[model samples]
Target: MPQLILSPWFFILVVSWVIFLTIIPSKVMNFYFNNEPETASTHKPKTHAWDWTWH
Candidate 1:
């Protein structure tokens, strides 16, 4: 309307979507809640659940 609300590419596309919602969703949720939480890869058995049973 009023020159597209005083353009300049509409205030640089609203400050680039407000810095893409304030910097990429808090750095992707702080690296997905700072990892190491899937039972630390199944209570550490060769990194991801192993230790079979048979003998």
Candidate 2:
């Protein structure tokens, strides 16, 4: 059987594709599924921004 020589460009291309498919999607999903609801729920609060000054 022939062997596939892994060049530097091939490594870079694979790493980029992995990051594109995996990391970006997880971040987007986390934001959409987790953070979106938290932010949306807190958005309607009557609290003022100055509330943090007491802390």
Candidate 3:
């Protein structure tokens, strides 16, 4: 019904779903990907000097 579609609760529900779809997936992916355990070997050694010469 048009009345149901225009109701405040329906509006709130739609907004909630939009927020969930837009926000939750990125947060979940970040949580899983960013929270991975890191090992020292996984890091690249820092270069102390920059080589200005082009090879």
- The clash numbers for all candidates, in the given order, read 0, 0, 0
The 10-residue segment with the lowest total lDDT in model 1 = 32-41
Write down the RMSD of candidate 2 (Cα, Å): 9.8
Candidate 3 off by > 4 Å: 1-6, 32-55
For model 2, residues 1-55, the per-residue Cα lDDT tens digits are 2346667768989999999999999888765444344434555657655556656
Q: For residues 1-55, could you state the per-residue lDDT of candidate 3 as single tens digits?
A: 7665657887898999999999998888766455668666876877787788977
Please write out the lDDT profile of model 1 over residues 1-55, one tens digit for every residue: 6665666887898999998999988887776454465534455445567677774
The weakest ten consecutive residues by lDDT in model 2 span 31-40
TM-score for candidate 2: 0.43
- lDDT score of residue 3 within candidate 2: 40
TM-score of structure candidate 3: 0.43
lDDT (C-alpha, whole model) for all candidates = 0.75, 0.73, 0.80
